[model samples]
Target: MRAQRDAPVDSMGAEKCMDQDASPEVHRFQVLVSLMLSSQTKDQVTHAAMTKLRSHGLTVENILDTSDEVLGQLIYPVGFWKKKVGYIKKTCEILKKSYDCDIPPSVQEICKLPGVGPKMAHLCMDIGWRKLTGIGVDTHVHRISNRLGWTGRNTKTPEETRVALESWMPEKIWSETNLLLVGFGQQICLPVRPRCAECLNSALCPYGRNPANRSPKKGSPSKIPTKNGS
Candidate 1:
């Protein structure tokens, strides 16, 4: 539980990368940009890159005016920085020309942006636009869902996991699922060698209940459900 409390996602995730006191439009754009930069990248790295970009003025016009090499350097060390550089530039142009330097207003339009995937689009909608259009399924949510027997390992992709979850889970909890599972994965239910012994669900979770997966560690998770609502 204490471990989960200090997971990087709690403070360094994409949702935490925005400038709270910025102008409304700039704040929304920063939220979208943060999600765009988060894919396949660790939370701390993305947060640092966002800090640099924010310091240099994280606006659509500013990013569009900046050159690729400099932008790459600003967002350096994130996964696929070279490709993200192009995504950022092209998305900024689209925002300026089509949306008038603001984020797209809907999930469908948001997904059309370069380098922005379904996961980013959903997160952008929820955080940038305050719309709970769908669940944002990243690696942590996808893996943890399966490990907890929610998906039965049938879903091969994050998108599939999202669809499966939305098909049954209450719409009200969709937004909470991403953050909860992401932090859980970062701490207790890790991708490899998970600390099942540290999880409250270890005695009940399918994978955690497995003898081989449980570690002889001493800790506890923060009120994780054994099943849907236990």
Candidate 2:
């Protein structure tokens, strides 16, 4: 899996989801917002939305002052843009009044925000606070972990996979698992009709070990809507 994780991972991923030149405080906020917009939205779409928001001023103050109509326009086309407009506005207010314009420092605290879940909270802590509170199990992670049998059983949800993985995975690797597997899932172990033939770990993978499943023929479902919409 590591072999498949090449330069492309660095070129496009969670690392590039924020503006590095911004002040430390604003940068952290940008990371949280980007993660918020990333749900059910592709990286490219989320990146584009962030670019628009930054151009118009992406600070918490600016988002709060902007009307829901204008804010929706800036982040248009992101999955659930209308709902996100409300979440972003409400979350910003909480951050300003409670966190002094910064995101919550703990995963538990972050999850308390409206529209936030365990996945977003964990990712925010990792990317925003540089602390790996837990694995950020998105669709890719959930699907790939199940495919590889890493979760021990067919975990039905991302949250289930999170608990299963954290139960035994090393403490040090908690942070990189999401990044490592997301790129792998995007490239080889795709959610739908995965190219099992090309996977280096196919020999050991449970799904790949099945003779009929290994190298699907053409005309099979090549794509399916995933959490990332890949």
| Top lDDT prediction, candidate number | 1
lDDT of 1 at 222: 39
lDDT of 1 by residue, 1-230 (tens): 53335678888987789889998789999998898888889999999999999998899999988999999999999999999999999989899999888898998999899988899889888888888999999999999888887875668999999998998899999997888889888877877768776677887788888887775544444344442334
Which ranges of candidate 1 are over 4 A from the true structure? 2-4, 216-230
Whole-model Cα lDDT of every candidate shown, in order: 0.86, 0.85
In candidate 1, how many Å is residue 189 off? Answer: 0.9
Model 1 TM-score, 2 decimals: 0.91
RMSD of 1: 4.8
How does each model score on TM-score? 0.91, 0.90
Clashing pairs in 2: none
Tell me how far the alpha carbon of residue 215 in candidate 1 is from the true structure, in angstroms, after superposition.
3.5
What is the C-alpha lDDT profile of model 2 across 1-230, one tens digit per residue?
45534523445565786889988889989988988898888777888888899899999998999999999999999999999999999999999999889888998898898888999899888888898889999999999999889999999999999999999999899998888888777767877778786676889899999887776669654533344435
Which residue segments of model 2 deviate by more than 4 Å?
1-9, 219-230
RMSD of each: 4.8, 4.4
